[model samples]
Target: MECSDARMLLVVLMIVVAGSRQASCNVVQFIFGDSLSDVGNNMYLTRSLARPSLPWYGIDFGNGLPNGRFSNGRTVADIIGDKIGLPRPLAFLDPSLNEDIILESGVNYASGGGGILNETGGLFLQRFSLYKQIELFRGTQELIRNKIGAEATDKFFQQSFYIVALGSNDFINNYLLPVYRDSWKYSDDGFNEYLMMTLEQQLKLLHGLGARRLIVFGLGPMGCIPLQRVLTSSGDCQEKTNNLAINFNKAAEKLLQDLSGNLPNTSFRFGDAYDMVNDVISNPDKYGFDNSDSPCCTIGRIRPSLTCIPVSRLCKDRSKYVFWDEYHPSDRANELIADEIIRKLGLSQLNTTNSFSQSTAPSPAPFS
Candidate 1:
C-alpha cells in the first residue's frame, strides 16, 4: 500500500478507537424546554416573548455581551455541557452555529415561550414546543445519516445520551391562563395523565430512532417563580400547582422505569429538579443563596421585564442568589442542582451522553 494510504488508515483507526473509548460519554445533551433550558434558539428565529436581547443576560459568558441566554451568564444546560466535557450545545437556529456542532454535542431545540401544546403561544411569536423539538431532533439524526453514513450514525445513536428538561410552560401558560382553563380543565390527575402519556409516546419515538440512554429532568417549583407569585397574587408557593408537578413527575418516573424494563440494559433515569429548586427556596443560606422569594433580575419580586435586558435591575452578586429572574435559576443555583443530579446518577459530569467510565463499545449490537 502507498505511504499516504497507510497514513489515512492510521487516522481511521485512531478515530474508531477514540469513539469506542468514549462510549461511556453517551450524552450529547439534546436540550428542550422553556426559558429555563433555552440557550438562544429563539434569538435566531423571530421577535417573540422568548427572545433575550438585553443587557445583564450574558454578563457571565466569556463574551460579556447578551447572547440571548435568560441568565446573567451560563444557564444550567450550558453548565451541564461544560461539566459533561462537551462544547456548549448550540441553539438550533443560530445562523453561525452549524450541523457540525449538532453532530458533535447535540442541539438545543428549546424556545423561551415553548410549552407542551402548540397553541400555548400565538403564531408569528410561536415557539418550538417539545413535540416540535423532537421532530427537529429526528431531522438532526437524518443530517447525521447523510454526513456519517448509516452504520456510524447508528453507533452514535446507541452510545449517545439524551437529556430532556421541560414542563413548566404547561403549568404556567396552559393551566394557569384562563384561555386554557376550560380547554385543559387543569386537574392534577388529568394533567398528570396527559403529560405522562405525551412523554411516554415521545420517549418511545426517540428510542425507536436510536436513543439508548436517557436522563429526564422533572419540573421545578413553579409556585415559587416570581411570575406565579405576582400574577396569582399569592406571594407564596402554590401547593396545588406544585402538587400537579409532583404528580406529573411521578407518572413520568414510572413510565421511564417501565420503558427501561423493556429496553434491556439501556439505562433510563429521572432527576428531581423540583426538589433541588425547592431545597434552595427552603434553605437559602445552605446553598449560599440570600433570597428565594425574589429574583435578582427584576424590580422587587415582580416578574421579569417583558423584554429581559441587562439594563433591567439585577442583583449585586448572582452567586448569592437562587434565581436570576422570575422563572429561571441563577447560574450558581443551576450548578448546585446539576451537582445533585450528577450525585443521584453517580455521574462526575453533567453534559455527557454516556458515562465514559461505565459504558462499553456497542456490545455487538445485541444481534451479532
Candidate 2:
C-alpha cells in the first residue's frame, strides 16, 4: 500500500475516534455512478444524449410521471433505498437541494453516461466523472460543516454508506469507441491497468475526504446488452466483450478487498453485478425474465436504434423483459440487481448507523 493510502485511512480513523455526534439509527446514503443508477442528473444537461424525456419512461413511478429515472420506475439505487427504508437521495443537481436535505438523506451524484474515467463519456457531451462526483460530495460536506461542525459532519459521514455504481461506461463508451483515442493509446492489458490505477486514486480520494463505508460496483457483462448483441450477426453475446468485463471485475474486486483490509473502520465492499447479471441472461426463467436478448423498447427493422427515444416501439409487457432499452436494464432487472448486490456483498456499513429516519414533514428544497 502507498503511504498516502495509509494516511487517508488514518484520517478516517482519527475522525471516528474523536467524533462527538451520536450515531443515528438511520444510515444515510451517498450514491455515485452512471446511467444505471441515474435518477435524473442528465435531464438537467441539455446536450446529453440518452435523456428519457418522452412518454412511458417513468410511467410507473410513485407520481406516474417522469422524474429523471431511466427505467419504467426506479433505478437500482432507488430500490436499494426502498428496501432499507431510507428516503431516496435527491440528485445533487436538483434545483432544491440544501444542507438539511443532505444531512437527512444524503445526495446522488451519479449521472447518465457517467464513467470512472473523466474522458469515458465525452461523446455524450455532458456527464459527471467519478472525480467530479466526489468533488460535489466534498462541497456538500463543506456546507454541512458550516451548518453543523467539522467533527459532527465527519461523524455523520463515518457511519453513512457510500454506494458507487460505475465502470461499464469506461469500457462501453470509451475504450470500445474508435472516436476515443483510448482504443489505440492502450493495449487491452494496458487499458485495464490504466483504469485500475485511476480507480485506486478515486477510491483513496473519497476516503481522504472522510468516507468510511464505501461500495464499488463491478461491471456486468457488457457483451450481453441489447445493443452489443445486435451488432453481431448471430445476435449472440460477444465473448470478447464479456472477457473485458470479467477481467475488469476481477481487478476491481481485489482492489476493494485490499483497501478494506488496510483501512480500519472502513468497509470497502464490491457489488458484483457481473455474476448475477450473467446468470440472469443465461437463465431468464430463473429470474422471471422471459426475454433477455432484445430490449423491450426498440426501433428499426434490422439493426435496432442505439437508444430508446420518445417514439420507440413499446413492448407488451416490460416486467418480463431483461432490458428497458438497448443499453439499460428494465426496472425488474434493476430490482434483482439491487437484491443480489445487497445480499452477497453484505451492507454491514449500513448497520453502523441505526437508521436514516424519515422526516415528519416535507423538506424545503434549497438551491445550491
Candidate 3:
C-alpha cells in the first residue's frame, strides 16, 4: 500500500473512534420533587421547617441513621434508582455535589417543602420550588458543558431519565392552609387549572433543555394522610380533599398524554401514584399491613402536627404501618410505590434483574 493511503486510513479510524466516544451516554436518573423524594436538600436551608433530622427519620436506611430521606429509609426515587441499578443522585445542595458527581449520577433537587408552584410553600420560609430546582439544574448543565463540552452534555441529558414528583404541596400547604391567597383566590377547578398550566410550562422547559425520557408522578390521596385525617372530628379521610387530588391527577394524566403527542423526541409518562397508593391505603391487609390510617413515627394522638419528632410516639412495628409520617410513605410502602412506578415507566415486562436498559425505554402507552 502507498504511504499516503495508509496515513489517510489511520486518520479516518481515529476520527470515527473520537466521534463514538463523544456520543456515548450512560443512563442515570435526575430526580425532582418534595418530601416524598427529598434526599435532604432542605437540610442546607437553615430555616426550612420541613427538614427531617430527627432520629426516627432514617432508622431503616443503610447503617440505621438519617441519610436525609423523609421516610424511615429510602424514598421512592431511591428505590427506583436502586431497582434500575443507577447510582443515587446526590442532593443538589449537598456540600459534596460537584462537577464530577453531576457527571457520575445526576442530582436530586427535591426539597421537603418544595412544590410545583413557587408560592406553594411560602409559609415554610425556605424551599426550592419547581422553578428554582430547574434553575439550579440549568447551572449544573453549564458546569457539565464546561467539563465535557456542549455536544456530549446534550447527549447525556437526552439519554438520562427524569423523575418529577411534586404538586401535592400546592394543595396541602398553600391552598388548604387558608393563610395563602390561593385558598380564597381560586375555587377547586380553578386551582387545578393554575397548577396544570404551571406544570406544563416547567415540563416543556425541561424538554427544551434536552430531557427526553421522563415521568411525572401524580399526587397520592393527600386527604387520607394522617395530618388531614387528624384534622377531622370523625378521624376519617377528608373526602373533599381527596376529590381535589383526584381531579388534579386526571388533569395531569391528560396533560401528559397531550404533551407526549405534541412534543417531539419526548416520552412523557404519568406515574399514577394516586390510584396506586389509594389501593394500598384502602386495603392494607393485601400488603401485609394492619393499619393504613396512621403513621408509624408520628406523635399519634390525632393532632394537626403529625411530625415524627424525637419525643413523638413510636409504633411497635414500623413494617406494619404504611405511612412513616403524617405526609410521607413508610420505607416498605415506598418500595411498593417504586415497583408501581417502574411498571408505569414501561418496565413491567422487562427483566429488571439485568438493571434497566435506557436503550429499550418505551413511550407511555396507556397501561392495560
Candidate 4:
C-alpha cells in the first residue's frame, strides 16, 4: 500500500476505536525505554554523557531550548501521548517537578542510553536500566495506592497504556561495542534469544504490577543510521546489523504472542518500527526528506566519533533530514514513527472483536 494511504487508513481506524470506547475512561500512559522515547530523564543523571540539554539539541523544538530530549524536537513518546489525548508524561528523574499531577497523568521512566539488559549501556554509569525503571515504577505504584487505594489503582493500570521502546542500545552499545565480548559468547540468533527472554521476564513483571494494555515497540533499522553508515567503507547500510534487527523483531512478535496467551485479561500490541523506518530510509523523498544517510547535526564524517556538539554545523531545515544526529531520528521521522505506532495500536484494537467486554477475550492480530 502507498504510505499515505496506509497512514490515512490508520487514522480512520484510530477514530473508529476511540469512538467505540467509553468516554469516561481517561487514558493514561506509562512510558519506558531508551533515547527514542526518553523525554529528558538523562539530564537528571550526573554521570550520563547522553545528555541532550545543550544548544542545537532542541533547535527545531519551539522556544529553541533543550528539554533533555536527544532529538531536534519531541520524541516518539511525546507524539504518541498527544495522539491518545494525554499530555507528555514528565520525566521521572526531573527535580523541581510537580510529582502529584505528573504521577497521576503518568511518568516517562525512559533514560537515554538505557536498555533491557543492565549492562547494555554500562559506559554511561548513570543510565537507568529497564530493571531500575521498573523499580522506580513500583514507587509510583505505591504513591497511587496511597492516594486512591489498591482497587482504584488496579483499575487505573488496566485502563492505562504501558509503552516500551527499547533494545537498540543493547545491540548498538553493548553487543556491537568493540570492547564488549558478547560476540565470543553467542551467535546473533543466540544473543537475540537471550535478549527476548530477558524482555519477556520484564514484561511479566509489568503484568504482575498491573499493566493490562501493553505496547512494545520493535527496534528500527539500526544499520541505516548515520553512525552505522559512516562505519562502512561504501557508506552503505550495515547489512549484518540490519539482519540482527529483523531477527529480533521476529522474536519479539513471538514473545508478544506468548505473553498475550499466558497473561489473562491483558492486551499486547507490537509496533513494527523496523519496517516503518526502513521504508523511509529506502525512499527518503517519499517521506519529504532529502537526506537519510547523513545527520542534520554532526562533525567529522558525520559519525558518532566527533558527536553532535554546539560547535557542529546544524542543518538549516531539520525536516529535510531523517536523523537529527549520529543515532536518534529527527522530530519529523519520530512523528512518522509515532503515526505508525498509533495505526498499529488502532489496528490491533479494531481486530479484537469485543475489546470492551470483560467476559470476552479477543485474540490480538499477529505483528505485521
Which candidate comes out best when scored by TM-score? 3
- Please, what are the lDDT tens digits per residue for candidate 1 over residues 1-368? 99999999999999988766434344466777777778888777766766777766766665656787887666666655566665556788877656566666677888887876665654337588878988988888898788767887777777776777777777776766677752457566776677778878887887887778788888877788766666555578888777778887888788888999997657788877667778889899887778888777776544455545455676677667787777777777777777777777776654534333232111111111
Q: TM-score each candidate.
A: 0.84, 0.87, 0.88, 0.85
* 1-368: candidate 3 lDDT, tens digit per residue: 99999999999999998766555444767998998889989878999888888877777765566778888778887777776767678999899888877876789999988899999888788999999999998998998899779888988888888989998899999989988999999999999999999999999999999889888888888889998888888988999899999999899999999999999998899888678789899999998988899887766464556357767776878788898788888888888888887886655321223333342221211112
- Local error of candidate 1 at 338, Å? 0.4
Sort order, lDDT high to low: 3, 2, 4, 1
User: Per model, how many backbone clashes are there?
Assistant: 17, 8, 0, 0
Q: What is the C-alpha lDDT of each candidate?
A: 0.72, 0.81, 0.83, 0.80
lDDT by residue for model 2 over 192-259, one digit each (tens)? 99999999899888888778978887788899999899888899999988999999989998999999
lDDT of 4: 0.80
Worst 10-residue lDDT window, candidate 2:
359-368
Prediction 3 TM-score vs. true: 0.88
- Candidate 2's C-alpha runs over 4 A off are 1-25, 300-302, 348-368
State residue 26's C-alpha deviation in candidate 1, in Å. 7.9
Candidate 3 regions with alpha-carbon error over 4 angstroms: 1-24, 348-368
